[model samples]
Target: MAHRSFLPSARAANVIIALGAFALGWAIYVRYALLEQSSVGLACRTLETLTCETRATVIALFSQSAFGIAALIGAILQLIRPSLIMFTLALMATCAGLVVYNNNLAGLAGGLLLISFARPWRGARG
Candidate 1:
């Protein structure tokens, strides 16, 4: 009977998550501690040039709001369904972009990389 044969690899999952968390944390720390804060504004300015000033501002604002919502929702999902991990990851990507736009390459790179590798959805897959 296909009742239960293979249980998820809790050890592996935990290890992945731990490492991912560490990577993410270190990334953020490096950004704030090592890199000059002014880089953030430069990142934002770089985003601004891609489009017209007026529209760019609006898009940036909307993205910021979405980022918050996504993070909140993702957190809530943690209790009910681990699958939200992917949503959280996607949101993290959005946040990273904003960070980079704000001239924070460290945050953008580290934060995004953390979630992508972590894979919260792993356990929730079943």
Candidate 2:
């Protein structure tokens, strides 16, 4: 068997890459007004309620998508790269999922499962 450590360390690199990707995704949605209008003005009475609900909707959408993507990527990366990078990516995705998914329990569960299992990098003790 090949001896390679996927331990979650080296503190890694390419985080900015992932961040940039996320930023790009957000920007694209904003620029294009792509997020559906279902949540907007769902309740016009009381400015505070409308604002809160709008924000919540956006967050829910973002989180749900983030979680699904993370799970998918984590699975693929587990087979493709070092564990550290995969773990880092999985962690980021989990955060996004936890923040945005409406049914947060499901999102959090999926994201955590991915993070918990990413292989450890070399010398990545703990």
Candidate 3:
């Protein structure tokens, strides 16, 4: 009999990755909505209900979503490979996301996951 590792299975890892991507996507969408609303200026007046307070709410939502996605992607990638490069990329993406809307997280996580899962790199030498 062989000893089995306790880490999450591939299916579980994929699910976590998908969730992180969704959070990132949602955050980007919220930011886009806020920007579009602000740029149009008087468009809010036509609605009669939109207000400055909503912008603050959207900003807060973006922050939380960004944090969740970053943390999830970072944690999951570390679990999958324990690579410093991957972790650094995740951290950078998360930090950059705070200042601007970017789709880097999805690409980074997706690429890392694909590479990590497509072939086992554990204990391989450069």
Candidate 4:
């Protein structure tokens, strides 16, 4: 039998890295554009424009830690049954949640995702 590698394939790793980077970039944009205490945020609060509306919607979504909850759930699922899709979801949500004022749960989820890296493949035998 061929030896099973501990880590994912290089292509998978590349996809994960690229997607994670994109997620982080998008999260950073959201944090600065719609959530920070800058002139943009001030305009979002004071004006009645499309950008402000979008900002309000984003704020509403994160108000009750929706992103954090999603990340936590996704991470839990990923830990139970590791897969690229679940990993990607958890990773993206963790990045967004952490940047969008949902650090508590997001941090926990990130820890779980890290732990999941040690989990064996679904069909791997001892």
Best by TM-score: 4
Clashes of each: 6, 10, 0, 0
lDDT of 4 by residue, 56-92 (tens): 8778879989999999999999888888888898999
Q: Where is the poorest 10-residue window by lDDT in model 1?
A: 1-10
Question: Candidate 3 vs candidate 4: which has greater TM-score?
Answer: 4
Candidate with maximal lDDT: 4
Task: State the lDDT of candidate 3 residue by residue for 70-118, as single tens digits.
Answer: 6447747765765545544554455435434434554455455444444
Worst 10 residues of 2 by lDDT: 27-36
**Which run of 10 residues does model 4 get worst, by summed lDDT?**
1-10
The parts of candidate 1 lying over 4 Å away from their true place are 1-8, 22-36, 39-63, 83-126
Give all candidates' CA lDDT scores: 0.43, 0.49, 0.52, 0.83
TM-score of each: 0.32, 0.38, 0.38, 0.83
Alpha carbon lDDT at 99, candidate 4: 89
Q: How well does candidate 2 match the true structure in TM-score terms?
A: 0.38
Regions of model 3 farther than 4 Å from truth: 1-7, 36-54, 60-126
Sort order, lDDT high to low: 4, 3, 2, 1
| Clashing residue pairs for model 1 | 39-103, 40-102, 40-103, 43-101, 43-103, 44-101
Candidate 1, residues 80-110, lDDT tens digits: the string is 3444344335345445334323324324434
lDDT of 2: 0.49
